[model samples]
Target: MSLDAAPGIIAVTLVTVATVAIGTWGLRFSRTTSDFFVASRTVHPRLNASAIGGEYLSAASFLGIAGLVLTFGAEMLWYPIGWTAGYLVLLVLVAAPLRRSGAYTLPDFAEARLGSRAIRLLCSLLVVAIGWLYLMPQFQGAGITLHAVAGAPTWTGPLIVGAVVLVNVMSGGMRSITFVQAFQYWLKLTALLLPAAVLLIVWAGEGRPRPDVDAAWSLPLADGGGIGLYTTYSLILATFLGTMGLPHVVVRFYTNPDGRAARQTTLTVLALLGVFYLIPPVYGALGRVHTAELASADALVLELPRLMLPGPLGDVLTGLVVAGAFAAFLSTSSGLTIALAGVLSQDLVAKLPQHRLSGVAAFRLASVVAVAIPCIAAVAVPHVSIARAVGLAFAVAASTFCPLLLLGIWWRRLTDVGAAAGLMIGFVGSGGAVVWTLSGGSEPPLLDALLAQPAAWSVPLAFAAMVLGSLCTPRRVPAHTSRLLVRLHTPESVPLDRG
Candidate 1:
């Protein structure tokens, strides 16, 4: 191998071996189906928090945010800010209530809250859709990272990640993945932090030269006038509201010991994410000063050390980043696979009478479905910026699940019929916009912009649909909603006949 290829190859090999090793170690603890699905609800708060941070910090955080920061300047910081703050929203609003509900997946929560199998089915499909959408970008980022580091074919990256994640998931399920993902959070943090520190030192030694970009690059909402402003706020809404709805994220809460543990995990995740996010923007700012001529802004972090230092040190930094990038792909892909697989096993695979799949068998089969579709789609679909694709996933999630979760937990008047209607309306509205945008049909500038970032409008429309529909059918509200609300809001320590 050439100088460029050897370090990348070594780093990737080590990361892969380490990941499989950690996963195998976790296998000993994963005996029952509950263990496979939620580690039997026994994971400690700190470890669970680390795993949540690992899985939640996807390709978008590792690669896409810096690219956006480089391209659009301060406005793009909203990506990371909204992402971290979303956990705050989860901490205060969703986490404890969700854990108290005792649902393994979003679909489980939907069914438990609304008492409707049809709604459960709809939530399952949405979970699958959002997981696939989110997974596609991780795979794409993998392709980009591998190509940058090792000069490999694009398809190889996604294929390698998909296969590794599938094996980790199938062998030991969530129990195994929990350990692997926790390790990855520290790995990713180390990967980004070391290079950023060295690069900042290098930048200072070179006399603190500023980027030669124009004034507009430093200003928020300076480009494209009204559309820029609209896009920024819409992105904010999507990410802030959307994080709670993500299937992979919600699945992690199920592993907590109880509602209080879930709350603690969310709080710790906010801290982990806050520290990790600070490093990416450093790459973006430094890239402008030193390496503006690179082909892709997304590659700026990987290329910066090499561009600035240009020898053994740069090469080593590249290797570390390559490992971190791959870790990002692996961790996020594993989490999504686990979440989607759970839904598939419970709602799809086991529902087939003739399949006769046992607990592990159904989950393994569902793992295949969860991993394969997105891997294929990643290759088939034209590559958008990884961050943009992730943002779209957030948009769909905010439109569909955010309203369902908020109203379901907080409102007694939220009827099953209303929830189903809201979900369908959100799905159709946001899903249609996603299809329209991805199909390469942007027109009538205003309409195109609205479709491109539909969250600001779609979210409210879904809420409105739910509220109005609930009012129209007030008699259909679940009789036990009040009691369930008490269970959700009350302290777990409080003695009551919850049953």
Candidate 2:
């Protein structure tokens, strides 16, 4: 509430203008269909890593993590740890294989792996479902950030963000967004890093008071005995396994020039995220020392600067943080939108027999549908916590695609029927959990915890279904599985002649 409209409005305008300008520069490189979808597969490792960091560090990192740290204590540190470590999982198991698959979208990879249109359709639905799931909190977070920024109607943030995303994404797709996202990442880092350094100095000056709370808060694990441990492990499972399954995250691999670049990109992302995450804990700690309990904890990042400094200096820092917060929403939403649009355009729009739409035209149309649906949902259901929603999205991805990708890339016996069975089971289990949480369902504490963090059970069940389903349908494995595996594993430089 102490946040002022002056800094908020200025921050919004500045970030928006800079994003559009960078996107415009990227448009020239987006003329081809390949450019629109995957940046012509020419992005460099460091540059692509920055873009990945930009888009990957969503409102969850910018706002939600600080709030959680401020309110819940050290147990919430798992969010950042699992999220970053998920990349290491990606690096070892998935980064190279996914790039070598030569697929533009997750469904394309599924279809290529299984040799079944049915499997493709299932992956497509899951992509849209997961994309929309991830996007809802971003849109909602935009509303929250903007509301704190300038007392704007809660709806304005979503609408404004939706329009900006549509224009940037619909204009030049991935090619256009590469520059925008990379710029936003550094901007976001500066915004947080500088403010955090100043705030820490101020806290030191004030004797660095400890947070006044229960002993349970500083414990690394949940306090609910067995049930608490379950929730903690489930959250860990979702975030750790979920990175490889996210469509936006996966599609970035496709943009790499080859498997090697993809691996390099993941490594760089780890370092960048490590540096960026350090600052949020600073704000959370400073909040403990300087500010009282906040009505909107998610706004802690924005409020801390203004409250702690309490002058022109604080207002200036507040403006910088605001810009970074807005950048978080825009960058993440754009990446999700691009990934969703690519899936929709490829699996739905391009296949429409009634319309003779060009690939670019179809992609443009898909982009509209992608951003519009979640924008509406964000506005309609505006009360969910940004961090929790993203975590759920991670859970769904872990349950569904994590099994498929891990199995498909490594296990050759994975039949189309098996993949389809596993995807459906994962979909239903994780989707059910999502529905229960979103619907505000509650029960005895244990049941609520189980459903709330369903990844522990849902993920294992999905893997079991795939393994058993494949073992049972041994003869149903695709005939080309051997050749495809060779291609997936072979170095691009040592190509086998197709002839």
Candidate 3:
């Protein structure tokens, strides 16, 4: 079944134009750096929740997760479950306090909590790396969707998405992005849900044949698996804890009016994501019954829409699916780009003595830098699995920022020496594993285990290393730890007075 490029392209083009128009209209209200960065810290809970849901459900959620379920069965459902539940953990453990701390980025939190410029710089580098890695799949997924729906060349999708993201992010920054993402979330949910209902009903009418539970559905990790259980656990650890450390995700918490609103926003996101996720696995399950010889398991979601609903109905549904896939691409890329641009503007461009680039100049330059590297990487390394690529990003996040944020916020005993040690250990351990995996070296049994699931061990090693290192070098602990804690937890209603 081939897609009719004209109607599908027209539909996708309309959706893209509408989204950009909405975002552009938002720019009139974004007059300050604060507005651009964090929506002036006044975003209501419901809108903020939708924006969070939009940003969180990227290409991985839209395409990769459903594809994974189709390819790997019950085990793959854990990815979405782990991902959605991570926000619950964030709400219970970190959200309120993180917002109350009033830090703009993870590095901002690091410097405030640990009082180490060196640690902050290291954290910044990791943020760029993780953000770039995460961005690649979004671009790639966009390319795939365009190719599937419009019969356009593969590059068309990424190019279109990359351009749209650059315009939205550069023009209005976070404020514009929040509105765009919130709107896109609804579009995405509707795109997936509507087709799913139609397809399911059609499927029921055609006689509800059970999926091959024994053939594909019943396979285990031991049977020609991509990675083993150890690796699976590591991935779970990364996705589960990585949300807390992601610069984009963490930055969203700061957009809330207060700590309580931040917590509420997270809860709303969980419900939104829960509703969106339920439909994907249904597509995956149905794909097993309707389609044969799926070229790429990652293409399962897109292909299912085309297979189940052929002709113009299928084309329209496919077009909506394409638009949602692009939404996944645009929303995720925009959020990451904004986070990256903020870091670059503050760290790289603003530091020059004679020339200070702030506001739109800094943002535009940062957007170019933010989008270019990942775009290049996406073009260069096109073969990596989207889900696994996302997992690597999570591993990096879990390894580096996860330790720093948890320790910075919770442990007053954390010292610069300890923080530095943990960062180095995490970088070397997780970074080396990633390098080994990518370099095509003969991975040892133990090394394979380590590389595949570094988070389980690496995270603990980082924490242990930090603690032991701090204990041995207590002098490096900031003397103002208690004062910092007080400031971090204190409500905004109370004013700080320095006499």
Candidate 4:
């Protein structure tokens, strides 16, 4: 069934215009740099939760997961479950402390906790790397969605979303984006859910045909299964820990009023994500019954509407799905760009004495730099799977910032030398894997295993390196560990000066 481009294009264009308008209106309330950066640290938990859900549920959650379910069967459900469950880990372990640290970026947190500019610099590089890796998939998904629905050139989608995201992010920073994302989260959920319900009913009315469960559901780690298992485990590790390390996700914590509020935000995010995740698997399972083509799996969510319900209803629904797919791209990319821009502004562009840039000017400049690089990469290398590229981003996040944040916040013995050593090991290990994969080099079995699932080993290796490095140079441990710990865990109600 071919999608007519006219209606879908109109619907997506309208939605994009409305989203930007609303974001621009949101800027009226954003008067200060603090407002732009953290909404003056006053965003309510419910709204923040929705924004988090919006930002977290990127192309992977919206389109890729359903596609995976269509192509790979029940095992693919683990991706969504792991993605949502990672929030539980974040809530239990990191959220509040991270919020209480009062850092704008991950590097800010690192420098605050470790008291090391060098460590902050290292963390900055990782933040940009992870953000770019994650951003590529969002752009790619945009291109795919536009090509599917609008019949436009594939690059059009990424270009459109990239422009919209830059406009929204540069206009108001976190202040405008928080509201925009919260709204988009509901828009995306409705776009997917309404069509899902209609399609399910249509499928039921036409006489329910069971999916080819036997062919797709078989599971055993043999007959070329070892590679799948290895990749799966690596993916699991990446998503499990990557949430904590993502600069965009971490930056959201800073928007909370306090550590406790950050924890509460995470809990709400978990519930929102859990509810949203249930819808995608339905699309996947239904796609299995309706459209079995492997290449069509990526278009499963967008195509299901037309397949089940033909004529005007299907076109409208398809248009809505197209708009939501664009939302997935725009919201996620906006958050990622914001995070990347913040780091680049602080670490790279801010170094010039004459520049003295601060607030919106700094953010806008960084946004341009942040968006341009990934935009080019998305266009230049459009063949990578959205989910796989996103997973690589997560792997990089897991290998680098995960160790730094975990140890920086909790381990008093963490030293600058140790942190630097860990960052170097993780960067080399995960970066090498990514480069090798991109290079298309013939890798040995063990090397391939290491490259694909480096987190399982690389993370441990980083931790060990950091610990050993620290022990060898105990003098490098910050002298203010106790004071910093006290500040991090203390309730926000307590005034620091009074204490």
Candidate 5:
């Protein structure tokens, strides 16, 4: 399944140009710190939802899910389902409360609720860590997409994406990122939808012969038996709980005008994501019939168009998919960079030299650092399957921030000491699994399964540790805990004062 460089190059170029164009347009609306950071909290629900959908649908959704479904069949459907359901969890449990808290970043929420600079500092570090973990896969996926399409060198793709993201982020910060991401969502959806529609027509013309599926591939949770069940449930937990914890995702909630808008935004996001996710599995099912011999499953979406209709028509379809794929890299990376840069500037960069630096200047510097670290890692580290790398990030988030957010919003007894201890436990436990995965080693089955999917154990451990630690240090609970809980849980229509 070979492709011409001309179409891929043209598609990538167009997407890059459009991203810069939209970002530059947004620069007109971005003049102050609030504008850059939260678009002055004036974003409408539908627009905010589009931007969230754009940023949230990273390489994993754009390329990884279809590939996994193609490789693993029915069981892998859990991934996309889990990802979409995660927002459902967010809508019901977190959206309005998080917005009502009026914090720009996750650490902002932690410090505001707990009133402890120590917990804020810890939260800042984890945000940067998780942002980098998540960004690395987008970079890796970019390299894969470019190499599959234009036959570019592996390193070139990450470098290109990093540079593009830095430029977009440094141009106007979050305001620019919001516009760029919103545009990309429609771009990506159209890219996948058009190709799928065309392919379905071609398949129908050929009488739509059923693709052969073995019993193992046809049956969900039937492959690895007990281990498979554990892995599926573990994946479900990670994706569902992890959505609220992702820095790129959570930061967007702060861009809404009020708690009511925040809930509206989340509902729209669920609808948008549901629509976008439906297309990937189509590619996966079609892949079984065409391009089944391709070496990498991730390239199934990219290669299928060309293989099915190998001519000018096929080239056009492949080019559209490539554009969408590049959009995925840029949009998701830009969102992650903005969130990471916000934390870095506020927590680390601004703290230097007696805190004299201006907000925008500090943010620009942070943007570079945020994009640079992961860009370097993307090239240096050996590539894992794109979806698995992302899942590891989700595991880290699930273990650490999931408990923090759920408890901080719902329970008034959560002390700073408890939150900190839980974070460290999650970090060390999941962090060990990450190290093991990256280090490359043969291992016993039980240990291997445990390390490979750490969310099952690590998430529970973090929650338990927080509960126990809080119970032991009940006196250390913040004095403002009750007030904050009321503000978080109460509806905006209530007559009580929030701040």
Candidate 6:
């Protein structure tokens, strides 16, 4: 199972260089605060969609999905299924209205919709919290990838990725990284797509053996009759509903020119994600047949190429996957860093004395801090299943922001008090579950499952809180709610004051 490291090292180096080169080149187009924040909101559908795909296809998509499928079998497919369908949820319920809100960040949206600085501050806190939770796994995955690629130490990967992302995000902000990330999306696609094609040909030549699937692994839902169904549905709920709430993902909609462009971008992202997701399952199936005994399932994609091909050809393919893996870490990490930096810098600009720093300078400072915390955490904390770690973050987002976004946009009755109540309840409930699981506490089976996968209970609870709180304080609803709803739902052709 051992292989040469030169090819992987080269592949990773090239990807890193290309990412930095593309991002640096994009600096030419970035001049103002708008450019740094949202690419001046002029990105068209195709490009914005590509950037979103690049950012959205984290290590979870590139490596973790295949690993999960290899280890857990059919039931894990719900992750990608739910993740992709989440955008459809986003398209129907959120995209246009969110863009119409004309907010720079989710917190901005909350503040505007509720007309409360208090709610905005609360949203900002959750954004940073979720961003850190999501970003940590990326650093962890980088450590795993580099370790798989060249037997590098685990700590080295996070530091390298953190340094690279800090440079990229600090250089030109979202405008710069959008170009870099869009290019990475295609690289990631090619990384898995071509390798799968070659592997299938070899697989066909070798008589097309079926994957070794036991009865339990073959089930669509997992094991444990009632419990498995609950876990599967809980996972589906988290991934599907969580996509809209991810700060890195949600902020990209702000990069589009208008609501129509946002919708178009989402459609494009759906198509791109659909294509990319098809490849991981192929790797998983092949893993079952070829490299079933590998020590770490996370390295299944990396090792499978060499195990089957066994020559210069194998090394080349492994290198390509390595490139894709690094791209996954950089693109997603860059996006998360940009998102967190945006929220942090805005806080600085609003709260700090204006003469101390300008927006861009404030952003640079924030980017360093945003990247540093999780980078340190990745090194200090023991690595967990990369996919599971990401899912927990999604569960947190689903429970919290899912309610806020849905209720804020559709239910004009959503008052600040209600929004605040919902967010706190959601955050504490899901975040507590995450901490409990992470801290390695487990006893009763039902209780373990409930805390491990909190979305099922937490999401409904948050939604209920928001609804009840809003109903109880009816007069607290903003006076401008009706006009804002009209603007949010109205066609751009009508030419109302979008301001």
**Model 5 lDDT, residue 423, Cα:** 94
Which segments of model 1 are wrong by more than 4 Å?
Answer: none
lDDT comparing candidate 6 with the true structure: 0.91
Provide the RMSD of all predictions against the true structure, rounded to 1 decimal. 1.0, 1.4, 2.3, 2.2, 1.6, 1.5
lDDT string, candidate 4, 28-92, tens digits:
98888787777888999999999999988898888998887776777777678778877887888
What does the lDDT come to for candidate 1?
A: 0.91
Q: Candidate 5 regions off by >4 Å?
A: 1-3
Question: Candidate 3: TM-score?
Answer: 0.94
Compared with the true structure, all predictions reach lDDT values of: 0.91, 0.91, 0.81, 0.83, 0.90, 0.91
Superposition error at 263 for model 4 (Å): 1.1
Candidate 3: how large is its RMSD?
A: 2.3
**Can you tell me which runs of candidate 3 are displaced by over 4 Å?**
1-3, 215-227, 439-446, 493-499
Clashes of 4: 0
Candidate 6 residue-wise lDDT, 200-239, digit = tens: 9999999999988888776779677898789888989999
User: Residue 288 error for model 5, in Å?
Assistant: 1.0
Candidate 2 residue-wise lDDT, 283-372, digit = tens? 787787775766588999988888889888898998999999999999999999999999999989999999989999999999999999
Pull out the clashing pairs in model 6: none
Q: Give the TM-score of candidate 5.
A: 0.98
The residue-by-residue lDDT of candidate 5 on 38-145, one tens digit each, is 888888899999999999999999999899888888888887888899999999999999999989999999999889999999999999999999999899899998
Question: What overall lDDT, based on C-alpha atoms, would model 4 receive against the true structure?
Answer: 0.83
Q: Write the per-residue lDDT of candidate 1 for residues 63-125, one digit (tens) a residue.
A: 998888888888888889999988999899999999999889999999889899999999999
